[model samples]
Target: MMTTPIPKTMHAWRKHRGNMEAVWEEIPVPSAPPTGFLVKLIASGVCRSDHNLLTNEKQPSWFQQQFTLGHEGCGTIIEVGDCVPSNCGFKIGDVIALLSVPGCGQDDCPECSRDLPQLCQTGYHSGIGQDGFYAPYATIDVRGAVKVPQGVTPSQAAVATDAVTTAYHAIHRRGEIKENETVFLFGLGGLGFNALQLIRAIGARVIVSDIKQENMDEAKKLGVPEQDLVPVGRSVRKFVEEKGLVGKIDTVADFAGTQETFEDAQYIVRQAGKMLCVGTLNHKNTVHMKIGIRKRLSIIFSYGGQTQDLAKALELIQQGVLNPQVEDGKLYDFPAVLKALEAGNIKGRIALLQG
Candidate 1:
């Protein structure tokens, strides 16, 4: 039932061992897996993690030496695998958003059995350590693909796979932020901005801090009060103390992951407050033992989101509750986009549209 002819080879952005720069090279087109589909990518999102994959020397043992580098993608199914269930409702020409880390959902699998598939170590992590959707076409397992709804643009659907969904998972699930709680949020980058919107949707009072004044300004436009924004170059600890919020913040969502932010979070949150960490700007961070023990604070870390989280995130976007501030770029702009993201030049998320 194949109609349109797929090319035998296509160009992709990839990382090679020892090379800090991503290489644009041609590779053979992949065939659909028995339980997956062959998709022609319409849009893909550039993540800060993409930069880490290219430059970081130390990586997980599962990371491939060389692999295509894009995890967030939206595409159309060009071919369907024979093993894909008819009841799954996926079909050729269906547009779908992909989950980068769709874990092996075996009954005996530890993470999947616990409903934590995002942490599944047995499955291939696309774009993180495996060939992912930076090419014209990529194959995805049925467990990782969700059909994109009507009226959702490919760009919105693409970034929702990770950028929006990850924030949703962190704020709604891991942080367990309630409407009446006061949250001190650090960072306003791609994921941080989305977190702000989600926090607003929950009707929580959020105090935002970022190194960039533009981001803080953008937060104001998003309905965050002027007083809640920590001024650029102002010490977060001092700001909290001045505002009489020391030991008053109900939760600290540290999406900045800087040493300063970490230290500030420890000092500012109330006794027994929750610390939800999602960023990794500095992988290794120090915790004050006395401060932690005295306050009895709960430190929580979140990673990727589940398929259900992605679906809910998409629903929020469709309903206009979550407005992901994404800028559009072309697929070939991968290198420049990563450079800008690393330099903190890009505001909000950027989705690269496929030609």
Candidate 2:
């Protein structure tokens, strides 16, 4: 019953096969779907994953028409379809953050039944599988959205969709980190920093490894002891020993995903320890299979989190278990943002707040 004047076309940042992708340009607005609704973009996180997608030229084969590239977005509902189920809890004018993928709540579907539809390779995902936000208007699967509460900024809500959820899934869920256990975080970027917070909240210890002194300094400010921070040039094995963490590191949540970090993490994890690969790296890793097999290490490559995981991330934010930081200025200038990302000009997580 509620309505907002839907535009015929609006300025957006899109991804095509060629050079036209990153500029702020005009594109037709999408229509509401029978099982979904339309969202008016408010804020979206300019993630490193987007940079990875660009550099890797990772548009999937199923894509015919080009889709806009942002998946971590928050917006207000504009159009509602009658066929959308009441159980989905969507209504016009509600502020929400999108699920990165579609989890059709089909009872018989294996993934949907287990609340892990992100694993359903056949399913549709935002940005990767369909046109995502990064536009003035975009469609959202009704079951694939979570309400953003008033206390959270739209920018914070947007990053919570991916950065926060992914960190939570990799840290608390997959890592299975118990209190007092030590976690060595490789690369203190967006996802890495969030995992630091969650691990800290769990009363666990976190040792950080970063190439930048600024990143190491940031870790100190976040309560990681200066002694626990390891500069990247140093060997991962040597640092693990110097910190007295040799054979003691329970989990290594690898956000850097470089060959060096990947191989290093595998070497240092304790027996039965889990190493969660959360970052998207362009390089290939060469693991020492003999050492890996001997340690009985559990190496898991994880992608995005489930929709329920996003809901849990929101709850943690509401409870002050996490604090998301977004860089000031450079909000909504997509072309410039992409340039900064490519040049590595921006440090930490940055958000683009747009209409």
Please give, for residues 1-355, the per-residue lDDT of candidate 2 as tens digits.
Answer: 5455786998777666655446466888888877788888788778766765554565566553556778888898888877887777777789998877857668888987887777665566777646777777888887778999768878888889988988888886777778979888897887888888888988888888988888788889888887888875888798787777878888888899998888888878898788888876746778788888898888887766877788888888988878887763333577677678768887766777773
Full-model lDDT for every candidate: 0.91, 0.79
Residue pairs with clashing backbones, model 2: none
Which portions of model 2 miss their true places by more than 4 Å?
1-4, 52-58, 107-115, 328-332
Q: After superposition, how far is residue 308 of candidate 1 from its true place, in Å?
A: 1.2
Error of 2 at 184 (Å): 1.4
Candidate 2 structure, TM-score to reference: 0.90
In Å, residue 226's CA in model 2 sits off its true spot by 2.3
- TM-score of each model, paired residue for residue: 0.94, 0.90
